[model samples]
Target: MEPRLTNPAGLLPDVGQAVNILYKSAHTAGVPGSVLELVHLRASQINGCGPCVDHGARAMRKAGETDDRLFAVAVWRETPYFTEPERAALALAEYATRLADRPDAVPDAIWDEAAKHFSEKELAAIVLWIATTNFFNRLNVTTRQQAPANY
Candidate 1:
């Protein structure tokens, strides 16, 4: 799709930089970058935002993620491709992204499951990444940001 805006975030010069700082801050926290990529891909897939999904997959591939794992991200619950930690993270991403689906979004069960795998700091980072990916998904979908090329 053609972009609806040349530089939607550019209207405010510091927007991109601000987002970058927050993203960088999250990266520096306890969660590994590789796992965060999976969270991003899963969340983007749920949002049906092509640009974020494309970018997330490319990020994973660049980090040496296998095709099997990459393809399994969307159906993580049914696949054997992920570890328990990854599954917990993906679950957190799903519930957080689709908050309106249930009355108690990010219910205690999912949060407790994630807590079983991650430290409080690590959980914070995963959550930040989830929130950030959702933000970008809405922005890209709203502005019709196209993927660099169809994959």
Candidate 2:
């Protein structure tokens, strides 16, 4: 899609501040950068947000995530590449992103499974991570931000 408005400077600063807070909180809450990236990629995939899918995947790779696991993330249920914690996180991300489909919030069973790998604080971070990515996805999609093929 063609670029609509090139001057985002006026609006982005405030949004950037919120993003900064989210990042700091996520790190402080004990969510690993890698796990955050995985959740980002998964949520982006579900939303079909190209920029996030591309950026998240690349960030994960740069952080030393395996290509095999990255490629299998969409089909994670069938793949043995992800650890149990990662799998649980991915499942949680999916539910969070597709919340309208469930409307009841994430189930306690899924929460319990994810909690096996995360402390309460970490779980809070995961929720924020998902929420932030969803916001990012909507923004990028609304702007029609395209992901570079190799990004």
Tens digit of lDDT per residue, candidate 1, span 69-118?
A: 99989889898889999999999999999999989988999999999999
User: Distance (Å) between predicted and true CA of 89, model 1?
Assistant: 0.2
* lDDT: worst 10-residue window of model 2: 3-12
TM for every model, in the order presented, reads 0.94, 0.91
Per-residue CA lDDT of model 2 for 37-112, tens digit only, reads 8998999999998878988888888889899989988999998898899999999999999998975768888888
Taken over the whole model, the C-alpha lDDT of each candidate is 0.89, 0.86
**Colliding pairs, model 2:** none
Off by over 4 Å in 2: 6-10, 149-151
Q: What value does the lDDT take at residue 101 in candidate 2?
A: 90
